[model samples]
Target chain A: MSCIIERLAIVGVGLIGGSFARALRQAGAVRHVVGIGRSRANLEHALSQGIVDEISFNATEGVAGAQLVFISIPVCSISAMVGAIAPSLAPGCIVTDGGSVKAEIVRECEKLIPEGCHFVGGHPIAGTENSGASASFATLYQGKRCILTPTERTDREAYETVARLWRVAGANVCSMDPERHDRILAEISHLPHAVAYALVHAVGTADAEGENVLSYSAGGFRDFTRIASSDPVMWRDIALMNRRALLASIDGFSASLAELRRRIDSGDSPGLAEFFTIAKQFRDGIL
Target chain B: MSCIIERLAIVGVGLIGGSFARALRQAGAVRHVVGIGRSRANLEHALSQGIVDEISFNATEGVAGAQLVFISIPVCSISAMVGAIAPSLAPGCIVTDGGSVKAEIVRECEKLIPEGCHFVGGHPIAGTENSGASASFATLYQGKRCILTPTERTDREAYETVARLWRVAGANVCSMDPERHDRILAEISHLPHAVAYALVHAVGTADAEGENVLSYSAGGFRDFTRIASSDPVMWRDIALMNRRALLASIDGFSASLAELRRRIDSGDSPGLAEFFTIAKQFRDGIL
Candidate 1:
């Protein structure tokens, strides 16, 4: 397990970035780590926890002499962060991201990086409701999917270098177009998040026969709405960044729900049974 | 833990009924158990497993010498089963049910029971995806809630007797009016089932950018839709029996989803954050 990377810069060393740093370090993949963030307290906390060897408030200063830069910031802020650090990065440096939405962020970042330096869009689709460097662990990315979205401009060597690092950290890396990644993720991830939030809101506000039904809910209701406990700011940003796909998904979901409502409303026994059976079969297939 | 009942009749020796027989026997509270069901093979399985002391195909014949009769059948079938067994039950027989919807079943069963006998509506709010007597367990109701719906006409001693049986099964027993039980369950249980089925249907049928996005889903989506794998016939019966309350809950859920859709469609960052924030807060409060 010799060192695969000489020096790495981790921008916004929160949960995702911090976990990346720790996982890479445990695998002996990276030699040096520089953590960057807006929160001085969080950066210092990361430094104290040995998650980062060094801490920097300035993006340009932190990325200096780094062979690879990994940005794990908010989706809306990624391109700007890349632009700020692009001038300081050495020639032939590879820059990758861990944003959930890829197409928009990838397009914005590809143009921001200077010539001779490479930008590869990536999404390590693993997370929890908890945030900050304190919540990170060395095995958070283990056995998870880390999708690399490589465009026409992406450097083959740089892409392999990024994928290799994720693989060493116990992630299954696969490559796809950034546009395809966003579309698929909308249905599987973002849309479920929106539906979970809406369900929680509905149950929280309504009372059945003057009883607060939400409070009396047991394992099934609780398990179904578990994703509603996710971080609000992160989810809000995701909903907006993946707006078109998410909105389309919402509409699609509404139509499906309406179909179910029709069956129940008309008391269509055969129709209802068929609907549930189809759903169960599909779910069982995936499982 | 001495024998609390000399003989017990279990009509429909399926998951609920079979589990009740197993749990009571393990607690040493019932000396004789007679399992009655349409599926002779399943009753034989229950008998072979030592879950029941005897097996009978006819409900009337099964309850001949039993002092307590427990019917764990579909909601629509409970009253008819009661009517069939009422004439055979001895005097002072305490009959109860394990139907999800109580109000309708209780009313129907109460009128069918003979004067000397009593009928109580009970719902064991616990189960798994698997069905039949083979899935029976001695601790299926451990640490779970078993809600009993008792009306003014319900016999006081008979209600306590039913409560004691569930208590011995390791259930937390509570009483509520049948109407209130249906209303609360519509929000907490029935509505969630409908939503889960609709979500599964939506993902199963749609392809994102010509890709079946469902095959790529992981833990969150699977856990959220676990209830969708439930028995279709049981859910269909529940939907029809609790139509009015379930329909109202569905409307409330649609409104909640529509509000969220508006927030995302308009790109209202603060509004989206507020909605998510409220949802997270509510979910947190319950947890």
Candidate 2:
């Protein structure tokens, strides 16, 4: 395959960003790669690991002549990074992001693109609890789903280019509106994270003879709380950035939990069994 | 190792009961094993699989000359099983059960012990979603915790014999008050199951443009809902059997979730971050 892009720039060279750069380099899809991050140590590590050809501390200077600028940062910082890099982008430079939430970033960053530049919202539904440059690998996105949200004003060529980049990284790309993407993610991702955090907090705060009940937690509890061990700041930003949809999801979850609680309290054995049956069927049907 | 018991009678030859019989038989700790259950097919399967030397449909008749009677059934039926086998148990037989909840079972079953027999509540902290005689294995109790709850009236010799049986099955035996056992288990086991079920029910009921959201569920969601795929009748019986502790845990979890909701609604970024940090720390500390 021919080189898809002559120059590629990635801001926030952490797990997601470093993984993207490594995968593209291994695939020989890009000629030059530049990494930008706030931490000097992480940038140095990325350089030594051959994840990028060059490094920059400033987003504006990083994308000076790049044909693609991938803003792989926390959800909260994506908007600011886009604004910072807008003035220095080359003509027709396609800008994309790797963040969990889509609507807010797309809404806030679309108008900041330069006249000849393009912006597309992208999210790769793949990661581990570990972060930083050392934790990234080339196969991080293999067999994963990458959702791209494009508005009516989005340039079709730019959107296709971003989708191709994800495909090169071994991801299956799907397209949907920003609003719908955020709503679907809220139900599947954000709501489950919230439930896990709440569960841990509840068990931690319970008065159970000052004993550490976690030592006795079985395989099921371990599996259930695995997501609760995610990065704190990243999840906090996601919970706030998608506040409206997340709140709606929480309401729906609360209502369902209340119904289960009511059934248990009323000694309604049949109702409880039916509730569990429905949940089990849905759980078993999960792909 | 010397044989621990001359004869072992297993009531309800399903997952737990069959597993106990198989594990003991593998250890060469029992001379004869009699399996009893309502399902003729399960009993026949257990006999064919070498999980038991003989099969019977009547619990009372099965324990006639047995020196050890192991009752493995749902928590709800332990009381009646105890009453049925009390009259048939030999003078020096040791009776024990494998049930999730201890207080209720111990309370009702202790009184039914015959004049010279002993009853000890045993709970092995091991199982999978799959149940039945076919799922039984010799190593099911290896490296697992088996909690024995003994009352004041319990015979010391019988309790030690039960503990040794669990040890022979490759389990670490621990003793605690029945009430304390129920309380701790409610937090670690029952509460997590309830949360998983509620989460599944919540997402299953969401309105997402008629799309099956579970089809889009990623690895995290799959791990979170695994326990929700458990046996519905089993969980329902557990919920009703340990109602008080489960209810308290539900209330505590609601409070925690409510606090998280308030923070998200107010856009308290730092507070949300702290909540996730605490949860992550606790989750990481889990063994």
- Stretches off by above 4 angstroms in model 1 are A207-209
Q: Give one digit per residue, the lDDT tens place, for model 2 in A162-258.
A: 9999999999999899998899999999999999999998887764458667777777788888999888999999999999999999999999889
lDDT of 1 by residue, A40-113 (tens): 89999999999999999999999999999999987878888998888999999999999989999999989899
Model 1 lDDT on a 0 to 1 scale: 0.90
Docking class of 2: high
Candidate with best lDDT: 1
**Per-residue lDDT of B1-287 in model 1, one digit per residue for the tens?**
98889999999888899999999999999999999998779999999999999999988998998989999887878889899888999999999999999888988988998998998899988888778999889899999899999999899999999999999999999989999899889988999999999988888888534787887787888888889998888899999999999999899999999999999999999999999999999899888
List per-prediction Cα lDDT, in the order shown. 0.90, 0.90
Could you report the DockQ of all the candidates, in the order they appear? Answer: 0.83, 0.83
Per-residue lDDT over B41-97 for candidate 2, one digit per residue giving the tens place of the 0 to 100 score: 989999998999999888889999999999888888888989988888899899999
lDDT for residue A111 in candidate 2, whole number 0-100:
83
